[model samples]
Target: MTSIVSLPIVIPLATAAGMLLVRRNILLQRVIGVVGSAALLAAAIKLLYVCYTEGIQVLQLGTWPAPFGISLVCDVFSGIMLVLAGIMSLTTSLYAVADIERRRTAFGFYSLLHILMMGICGAFLTGDLFNLYVWFEVMLIASFVLIALGGEKPQMEGAIKYVALNLIASMILVAAVGLVYGLTGSLNMADVAVHLRDVRQEGVVLGIAILFMAAFGIKAAVFPVFFWLPASYHTPPAAISAVFAGLLTKVGVYALIRTFTLIFTENPQLTHAALVVIAAATMLSGVLGAAVQMDFRRVLSFHIISQIGYMVLGLALFTPLAIAGAVFYILHHIIVKANLFFVSGVVHRLRGTYDLKKLGGLYATHVWLGVLFMIPAMSLAGIPPLSGFWAKLAIIRSGLEIEAYWVVGVALFVGLLTLYSMTKIWAEAFWKEPASPGPIGYASTSGLGWMVVPIVLLAAITVAIGLGAEPAFEVATKAGQELVNPQIYIDAVLGGRQ
Candidate 1:
């Protein structure tokens, strides 16, 4: 039997290569894409089971010893992230098959999609800082191509700004890596973490930390670095945008959490305080921005920033429960955010416009689509009995436990604003009367099954996570413990070597 350890990266890379070979055959391309994603999903589920049964699994690639060759480590956090990325990619593949008109363009899209997944999975699993940076580039380059693939004016404009900003962020990240390498004489994350503990140059450490924050913050779409998201996200095809919304920013947040917990612990006071302020600003600014957006997708884009604040708040608190909450929130947000974007795609396919003012009466024509949209929207708004509610509850409860009164207040206020914004989308897109008496483009009666299947699956997973919170929370907590300790991770990466 093949080891489950390397499948995440291997499957995607092999599949991308296969697609490249068969790029001229449209049917084969789609088959390769769907099969690859399905294989990835299966592998992720198996990895999750392995993690549950056997604990964290670490694989040093090429059978090389740790800290000498590249290593991939899987724990609860990376395992769950792998599954989420797989789900998003799988669903988006189905939606693309049904929605994309240009078949040739789709081959490239799917190719990039697989490469992007490989990057995300590698970033999550890698134990080396330089490898993580390489994965980050993989993600950024693929995203730039994906965003610009459509060749529309809006996509072109958005891709330009996106490319420029992300390039700058990447450069800063490289500089940080160089600085850390020069300081510690190692590029391995665990090695750096161990060395960082004894270093006394607070000023230099703070500077490097800030560089990382700025770089990852841009990728994650946090405040002050978040302008590009709303302006460009709505321009892509719904399926492409859905995948990006679901997986890309979360990668950055994941990096931030990993670095802070593993390597930057020496300056907790400065690091935590800075993250706290950013978290508060991220929440307030994101929600308020969402509240004013009339475009359905744009509103959701802004909410991504707001919800990210909750995750970062958990990190800033730096408590066990808070870190677990952040993990849970990331899992919750991935599913809910992607499904919400998928719903937007469904609406666009049926109604021919994403403008909320021009959309209405969807509930009457497409009852099931309305229900699908409602599941994620309500979840995103943090309604009870859903995953989003528990995620928010975890963060807010952690905040209160730590006496972060202002963070708690800001979180609650953001929740209310989130609800308001969700309601606006619901009322404008579903409840009100349609502008035209006749049915819209697709009539909402046909070609929707493909779209709704994925949304329904994601929503079901959200509910399942909430209802089965104990195990998931346990996994998240374990992941947090590993991160907070850093010894096991560092040893796994660097131990038994000269």
Candidate 2:
């Protein structure tokens, strides 16, 4: 049972080792990759069940105590994130196996994908700040390789900017960690929270918070720091891009939530005000940018920034319901956003280009594809009877309760803008008639069951979550409570913090 804490890392590390051994055996490599991802998914589910039945679990590596040894803590928040990461990795692995053209590099790709997942899981589960930094580096290196895998010109270009910006962010993150360690004499998050309660340094704490925010802001694709995302995200293959889009930014947001809720809770009045302003600007700018985009993938990429604002907005509200809504929104966005990108991959495979001008009237020829795309897109746009609507309702309800009229107004406005942008894609791609009818000129591939399977599965999950909101909301509420009350997590890690 103690070893279960490491299953997330173990599965991926083992898969990477196996891939290296069977580099020449393509079928074996694929099988190993899928098996590894499936195993991780199972582990995540089991972990969630453990959280529900037995409460929070903490594992200290090597049996050493906290503030001395590495610790992994699983609260409801970490459990939910684990589950979401597993689902995305599993589905994306399936898509990559079938859709990727470079077979020789496929093993390497899966290895990197698993490595990224390992880092994400580690980051979420770990209770130490410095350990989280190490995981971020792991995630970054793997992402660099994944983005640049094809050696294409655009991918290379995007990878360069991505790596450069992320490297700088990493450095800033480390410097912030050093400052926090210097101030608190500890690298463990639980320890830092306890220390901060006694020591007071207004300027230093705010400065460290700002540094941390800047580093995570770049990673989260917030407002001014978001240009790199739109520029780089569309360059990768859809499978790669979908997973990156779905998971990477959310990790940054997760860090923000964890850090603020635990360590920085001392001054929410100041932090919340700043976060609310940032959230509003991020929402407006992202949607406005999406409205002008001509490429389908690019449009969705910009909307990622906009939708992230909603999640951050929930955090800014600083209420239980709002926080729960943010948690639920993150889960919803991961599935819907990834599925949309996969649908774009299918459309690109069928129609030859991602430009809206070049794509039209797919509804007539490919009704299934149209329907598949519509479900997630409409859900994203906050149409009723979908998962997106519930998330929005929760956030807005919280905002109104807190008398955050401005934030609520911006959220409503962003929701409408989201609808408009999605409708633009629908009008251009599916509804409008294309210039030519039979056999669009892209890479016409026949058995695309692997690609379609994941998309359909995610789409179904999206609808299921929408219809089954009660249970999902319960999980999210539990996660939110755990986040707000960090003592349970701290105690689990440090043998009961004071």
Candidate 3:
């Protein structure tokens, strides 16, 4: 079980090293990237299965025990996150084969991508606050390089903004961790949770909690802090944007969920109330931002912020069903969002511009492509009998259960705006006739198999999850139960010592 827990991070790190060693051979590097990511995906599924059947799995490094050693903990929440990472990594690696240019490939793109995956996995698995900080730095470095790989003016600009905010986020995280250690005399998350119960410095504790929230909030891109995302995400290549859209901010959300649930519950009235406000503001602002954007990728980028609001809204509600809604939202959003971005890339390939004014007739020419785009797009908009519908329904239902009527109203209004945005994309990109139409000349389909397959697979998964909501919701509900009761996690890390 421990071996399974370790494999998610280890395989990617090892594969990245292999990719570097064979840097001269671009073909070999691509092979390793795809094969290695697939292997990691398999391992992630296995880890999820083990956790589902055997409970939380923990690996203490070097045979050391408990608070004395580094711990990799896998509960249902982490397990589901790992599986999502695997799916994204595998699909993105496949997409990059056709989507990333050869110059970028030769410049170690595969290595950096795998490194980013390793960091994501480590961040999800680590049971120590300090280690999570380390993983954040690792992810920061890898993503910085990947985003800046092309050295285009916009890529560099975006990378600068991305790194600048993230570096501040890192510093804040370190300070928060330092505060936690000083107060609790521990860096282990479970240990900190136990020790915090005995700590009497309520003022300092809540202060530290706020600092942590600010730090992760920047990473999560909620509300006022989200300017960095829309400013930068659209500047990158579609493959990079897809991965960033799917995983990066969600990592911050995962951190917020973990820490708030496990260690920062000293003042729920103050803490959770703050989250509720942030979530509502984030949703309204993001959807409204997307509503006005004319650029294809830019609109989708802002929508990411809006969708993130839904995920965090579940957390703010702080009930089991609400958290389950959050868990389900994470699963649904990562797939639907990434698929939409990939579909954007496909559109870019056909039309050569992300500007809505320059693009159209996709549905008329390649009807299958339009159908593919609609699956995830409609799912994202919360259309019924689709994955996003179930996710949005779960959160809205939980809100009703708790009588959070105002937030529920805000959520429904956001959904309507989301539908408008999706319709705009559909009208401009797919339904409207191309102003200047012919072949819509671009790359040949021969090279696009790698690109198209992943989009289709993800879209199918979206529909399957919607149609098969029972098991998926069960998994999310169970994961939510684990989060609502953090003892399942703390006990796993401490080996019953707590």
Model 2, CA-based lDDT: 0.89
Q: Per-residue error at 32 for model 3, in Å?
A: 0.7
Q: Give TM-scores for every candidate, taking all chains together and pairing residue i with residue i.
A: 0.96, 0.98, 0.98
Give lDDT tens digits, candidate 1, residues 286-323. Answer: 99999999998999999999998988888889988899
Clashes of each: 0, 0, 0
For candidate 3, write residues 1-498 as lDDT tens digits: 477789999999999999999999989999999999999999999999898889999999888897998999999899999999999999999999999989999999999999999999999999999999999999999999998988999999998999999999999999999989989889999999989988988999999999999999999999889999999988888999999999999999999999999998778899999999999999999999999999999999999999999999999999999999999999999999999999999888877788887788888888998999999999999998999999999999999998989999999999999999999999998899788875344645556788999999999999999999999999999899999898778888887686
Q: Ranking by TM-score, best first? A: 3, 2, 1
CA-lDDT, candidates in order? 0.85, 0.89, 0.93
Error of 2 at 103 (Å): 4.2
- What tens digits encode model 2's per-residue C-alpha lDDT throughout 329-353? 9999999999999999999888878
